[model samples]
Target: MKTPATPPNEAERLLSLRQSGLLEFDNRQPYDRLTRLAKRLFNVSVAMVNLIDERTQIAKSVDGAVPAVLPRSVSFCGHTILQPEPLVVNDARDDSRFVDNPLVAHENGVRFYAGIPLRLPDGAVVGSFCVVDQTPRDFSAQDLAALSDLAALAEDEFAASCAATTDELTGLINRRGFNQFAAFALSGARRRAEPLTLAWMDLDRFKQINDRFGHSEGDEALKAMANLLRSAFRETDLLVRYGGDEFAVLFADTDEQGAWIAMQYLTEQVAKFNQTGSHPWTLTFSWGICEFDHHHGDLEQWLKEADRKMFSMKQKNSAAR
Candidate 1:
């Protein structure tokens, strides 16, 4: 089996995909609903919305029995993203590229495949809205047209999801988006029996910065902090502009020690930023982290605890001042 080569502009493609901020979140209702519709309309055993990460293809939404992930080396979607056009493999066994592929050789082999590229707003093909079947079949022009239409619908859903959840000023996840996505993140963590950490952060003396430097400078400060957080944390973590001067980070599958280490890393990054003397004012923040145990009850309770811890730390810092 011949593995597909990476795209020449893979760096830009991955960058655009990351900019969408969809990778940090879980299976959303919009994508799932569309996949379900595609499965029914195409009469396929599997319909999925996939996102191609550097090493894996994540099935962000699926309406069939396929695994949620597959290695990039063997992923049909990987080859599909190389071009703007749909990839139709009528029979994998007849194709040299996939004839000996494990997925093709398995008992539940993939004989029919149709993958329409799911492009971002910038026309970067991140993955595919694809359908698969065990039986070899031919696709008509009408089938391709219908599949393209469904893929377009998936792209529309992505744009809408981003618009609704993204912060206009900072490009971070907004409160509305965080609430929706975090719930899914927590549920997934619980199912996997992994520790999850939530941190509440507030900019120190942010109102003073705004009052002294004007709202424009204050906006820059917020953007600067958002950039720092983005760089410091794992891409999988959910970073949010929770409110004016406030932010939240959800660190999935992290324990308390891991949370502290991340906080320390952020602190070091902030110090380095201050040393640069680029900004008119130094940026500092107070943060509180709570690792969610099953005992934490619900998200509401976990948030409150984190908030309280943050305030307590803020008070101590104030006392030291």
Candidate 2:
């Protein structure tokens, strides 16, 4: 098997594999549509949208009366996956890549193969949505282009599933799906006695924006902030919109001072945004942040401290302005 661009954490390998199966494949989802489309377009006996994990090749969607999770070597997809592009085999028996493979020699007889290697948004060559036929066949330019279009649709579905687990509003880690992840991060932090932050955030004067500018304008401002937050933070950090204008940013492997650097950068950007356009009204927010403390018992204490700090900032700003 080819090595992952990001080294797989073997400790988390099982967890990652389980989640991949859960996230990528749903018989009722767009993947099912792609498999059906593949079968029709190629006129193949078998077509599937698959993801290749370390040990198993899972069919996210399969058509033409086959079950999921075929062995990786039995799959022609294994060879198609090694490089970073599409692999088109007019005749699998003639192609050196699959000439000696069991899928071709045995009664299963995978004579024709074509695969467009699915690249994850992170650039990992995961697997492909491919069509395999028992008879040798060649694809026209139109067929190849149609396959490309269907793969693009599959990519969109994959991205949406991943984005669902995180917060879209504040660009933070969402609570809805992050409980297990939080437990894992917390365990590692406690073991090493490293700093782990779970700071909750609430936008100051957020309600005022809606009250003053109308709700649509308020949504635009929130989305604007969300964009900036996503751009500014490290990929490892979790940013979530807890609810309404409330948010929580978790900074891993950082001290109070390091977080302050990120926080200051965020504050500066928000200040710059406030200066844009001459609409006669501007926007700003109060932020709350705190370091995770094992001595304080649980995550709630950390949130309370962060919330208090944010409320204090808002109060001081209110008095001065």
Candidate 3:
């Protein structure tokens, strides 16, 4: 019943959701099968695997009459993703949050609802695995545990598909996955006339860490840096492990000024991270930003520009050091 507000990492969470390649994908069997099982096991009229996008909750799989897309404002799944645990409403009429909600007040009353957040390995809650019924009913502890297990299966499917596109070392999207999803993401940005910024970055002195500390330490540095980048950027940004010691982020709906602000934020975050003493060696990165240009009409060309700028910054940093 509570109006679900955006989480702190909304941008990153949404980006994680988009990178899954689930929204545009038609209803697939693994997802559909899970929902079917959830519906029957819970004895609910409807079961769904839903992903909450910017403005809408998209039903990736559904077992009942629920629409493919529902407004986020009206979505119980929206509230469901706010927490790490399952959200259960035994009787919507009893809860103030849903007593007047159209889904509850309308004839097709949603009297009993239970949803567990579908979390990505990166700790992003992209949506919910949920069941709904028109008739009021109480769910036992066993029921919640069962729902959680089904949600885990749903997460397993996400992890499997994500693995194909993810870098094994850092859990960031790999180059191949980036190429696959970036085109679709760019197309959406163009359609909406939104500004897109690409930040191409390389770690400063990454090789030095490997030489001094060992390969194990080098891997740790990569992961540490990836975690920093994840926390610093928006969920909407496409953060990728382009290769060893190099990473790339595509910021959507952000202009040059906005991109600059984001970069500044990262600088502050790194400084704070260094103070934490989490790593034996300090990490620093040089980056270049390329704003999307309609004239280029080529992703490769745009990335090349970013690469050029990044090299320039790296050279400058080396000279300063």
Candidate 4:
């Protein structure tokens, strides 16, 4: 079997794919009203404001349309990523690109489409402001111009999705958001024949401090650790609390050798915190760094493998002392 061709600009693509801005969009009446206006103004049967990411095309604001996500490759909005101005397909059955698309063959009876490009803050084309129709419809230059205006407004929200994963605690990514980031990072590392590390850190025996000093003190310690973690790592890296004494960081674009060096730096600061704090003991951590591989299976399995290695190293350290 032939392997798939490697995707171009893998890192940039991963970042682009991790975007979920429109996925979180509130399907309110105003959003519906806007798309409905677009459809009626353009004299079309359907309209949708589609946010196109790496794998899926999400209908954030849709009016007079189906309640679903269309596959990214098949969606007419995806073509806007490749173009400068509005993409108008007067008849999908006649267009070479749309002829084989399933949506053209059956679903939605999409005979015509017009999509204007939308961008994120980083200036990446991430979605489109498009109107679709069951019958072939010609768009006047006037309709095209109006959609362009609306496309710019949608781009504003698209830009906000870039920072959607940030954690308020330390301005780091939260647990829920980091999983997608981490996976994409690993995929890039694997594709480029580079190295990436899944680094897991847990404060050694942290429960004793919370038990002795009280939960308020525990909260303080967590905040302190958050600050330290922020300072110790680069802004591009992802740090997430795995909840209760453990935190995980994905060292994107890093190798095993480099990750190990960083791990030592983390351990030293955690030790210093343990030593200087007024509690009976300072906080220390056990960490495991795993360089990524395509064969590590899914995200859960890869993390488990890293955790096992970390636990093994921790046990060995304890035994040595």
**Best prediction by TM-score:** 1
Task: Return the TM-score for each candidate structure.
Answer: 0.56, 0.50, 0.55, 0.50
Candidate 4 residues 1-321, lDDT tens each? 111122355367446544443443343454566787887878777778776666677887888756558777667776776666789989988888777777778866789989987766766666678888898868888878898877776665555554556554445565547766776776776788766678887766678779988866776677777878877887767788755666788887787788888878877877777677565556666778777766645777778978888788778767876
Model 3 weakest lDDT span, ten residues long: 19-28
Ranking by lDDT: 1, 3, 4, 2
Q: Which residue pairs show collisions in model 4?
A: 274-282, 274-283
lDDT of 2 by residue, 110-210 (tens): 88878887755555666787888889998888988888888888877766655466554444455544554667777888899999866555676778889
Q: In model 2, how large is the Cα lDDT of residue 134?
A: 88
Report the Cα RMSD per candidate: 18.0, 14.3, 17.6, 11.8
| Pairs that collide, model 2 | 171-239, 172-239, 172-240, 173-239, 173-240, 201-247
lDDT of 1 by residue, 56-101 (tens): 9999899999899899899999999988789999999999999998
Residue 234 in candidate 1 has what lDDT?
Answer: 96
lDDT of 4: 0.71
Model-by-model lDDT, in order?
0.88, 0.70, 0.87, 0.71
For 1-321, candidate 3 gives per-residue lDDT tens digits of 567788888999988876665554343689999999998888889999999999999888899987889999989999999888789998999999989988899888799999999988788899999999999998999989998999999999887766577777788888768887789878988889888888999999999999998979998988988998999998978889877788998888898789889988998998898898977899899999989886566888888999999999999999998
Candidate 3 residues lying further than 4 Å off, grouped into runs, are 166-176, 179-321
Candidate 1: the clashing residue pairs are none
Q: Tell me, by lDDT, which candidate is best.
A: 1
